[model samples]
Target: MDFFNILILAIVQGAAELLPVSSSAHVIVAEKLMGLDPTSPEMTMLLVMLHTGTMFAVIVYFWQAWRDTYFSSGHAFRSNARLIVVATAATGVVGLLLLKLIKHLVAGNDPGFEIEHLFANAKLMAAALAAAGVLIIASSRLPERANGALNLRTAAWVGAVQGLCLPFRGFSRSGATISTALALGSSRRRAEEFSFALAVVLTPAVIVKEAFRLYQSHALTVAKNGTSLLQLVGPSLVGMLLSFVAGLLALRWLSRWLEQGRWHFFGAYCLVAAVVVLLVG
Candidate 1:
């Protein structure tokens, strides 16, 4: 891909990744419009790097809040640590199971099947976007509940919902997880904090998985072309940097809207975007 194309994808991924609107959906559509193959190994590698950039943005933006909340005391630290572990465990189990089911149902006996093949499906992306939008709107409309401590049950619920987002491109992870937290009576502040915390935990695993998949699928091609893996991923470094900046800006916007009780507006935007994706994609 050219530098211009990489920059565009980076911007799209960076902004949309932090927002309730799905980044993968937007990135895939952008790739399609630019005549790039979303399922290609290089594109997958680029996507992983873009995610790494946003993951760092989450850390940078949330570091102080996390320190004050999760690390203020020994007991607080332990309790939050346990919650994170449980939630991450739940996410892994549910996400893996769903992935298995999807592969079984979609690929059947095909030996070379991979879920990335579905990343560019406009109909599926639209449906997933609509689902995420409804969930966000419903949660936002619920009556305000008292702010409560993060509990294991709520964490598990949030994680499970997050798992549901794994296989579906337009199903926003932050949107579903944060909405689940809110609908389960968590404060908006806590919901945002916890959702991003889970993101920080989950992203590394996803990057590793994508990297492995890229190697498995494209190692031969790279060898034949006499290209090193580093060479293939070199252009993505620029995209990562661009995405990091965009992600920081996006996080600020998301936080402001969430705090100002405009959370449902994101859902409305998602609904509209879904229609646009369907029409143009």
Candidate 2:
């Protein structure tokens, strides 16, 4: 990819990663529109970097809240910490199982671009986006409640929804988890905060997974493609920096908009985006 293409993709990844919109969907669409191959190892590496960048953004934005909620000595803080742990564990279990299922169905027999049913599959993405939109819109309609005071059952449901998002690129993890939490009677701010905290907790595993994949790809490449793996490092770092800056802004905007109950606007936007993608694809 050229500099301009990489710049655009980085911006898209950074901005979309924090929104209730799926960064994966936005990045894939950007790759298609830019005539870039989504299946390239370079592209995959860049994506990992972008994800890491947004992960950092989440950490920076929520540092204070996490300290207050998880590190405080108060009884309420301890209880909230336990609840977050339970929810995070649930999310991990659900996400792993769903990812395994997708792997078996798509990447099991034939692990190639054809097997990449999760990428650039407009129909699937559109449907996933619509589902997420509905959930978020519905959550926005519910009565507001206190932040960070979730019960176990509600936390489990949110975690389960997060797991479902693992296999679908258009299904935003943050959107699903936050919406599920809200639907389960958690307040909007609390849902969003917890969702981000979970992200901070889980991001390292994802980064490690991608790093292992990148290593395997390097060691097992065929003697046909005359590309150097090292070339991706610069682009990946650049993309990561860009994504961090953009993601911070997006997170702030999303938090403000969600608190004001303006999330239906995103739902409408997703509906329109789905229609456009369906027609284009």
Candidate 3:
């Protein structure tokens, strides 16, 4: 990718990643428009790097908020930790099961199928976007239950919902989880906190997975560009820093809008976004 291209991707990834919007979908579409292959090793690696940038942005943006809310006392920490575990485990089970089912049902007849093949499917992306949009709108319409925290049952439901997002590219993980939390009666702030916490927990594994994939698929790109993956790391890091800045800004907007009872606006945007992606594709 060129400097300007990386800059655009970085900005888009950073701005949309933390919001209820699906940043992956936006980035892939942008790549398509720019005449780049989303499945290439370089692009995949860049995508994960951008995610890492946004991941740090979440930590930086929410550090104090997390400290006050989640780390106030030992008991609170333990309780929150337990909830996170339950939710994460639920997410894993549901996500893996759905992944398996999709693989078998969608491509069982083809032995050489990779889940990545579904990443750029425009119709699927549109459907996912619409699904996320509806969930967000529905959850936002419900009254917020004030001062709520994640309990076992609620966390499990949230986690299960998160798992469903994993197999589908355009399904917004944050959107779906936060929506599930809200619909389950958690307050907006609490839902946002838990949603981001899950993101932090999940990001490292994603980084590793993308890194491994990049490693496995290195030879083709190496021959084409005469550049090693290691050589690309420097530029990727620059993109990461750019994304981090953009992520911080996006989080500020998301928090403000969410707190001001404007979450449904994001849902509305997602709905429009779904249509746009479908048309553009």
Instruction: Tell me, by lDDT, which candidate is best.
Output: 1
Q: Which candidate gets the maximum TM-score versus the true structure?
A: 3
Better model by lDDT, 2 or 3?
Answer: 3
Model 1, which residues run further than 4 Å from truth? 109-111
lDDT of 1 by residue, 1-281 (tens): 99999899999999999999999889878887899977677787898899899999999999999999999999999999998998998988998899889889999947787777787689999999999999999999987666666799999999888888999999999999999999999999999999999999999988998888788758776767766778768888998999999999999999999988999999999999899899977
Locate the minimum summed-lDDT window of 10 residues in model 2.
109-118
Estimate the TM-score of every prediction.
0.95, 0.90, 0.96
For model 3, residues 55-172, the per-residue Cα lDDT tens digits are: 9999999999899978999998999999999999999999888888888999984778878889878889989999999999998899888976678999999999989998787899
Better structure of 1 and 2 per TM-score: 1
Give residue 82's error in model 1 in angstroms.
1.4
lDDT of 2 by residue, 95-173 (tens): 7777677777767745553324566678999898888888878877888876536888887887788878877878888
Decoy 1 TM-score against native: 0.95
TM-score for candidate 2: 0.90
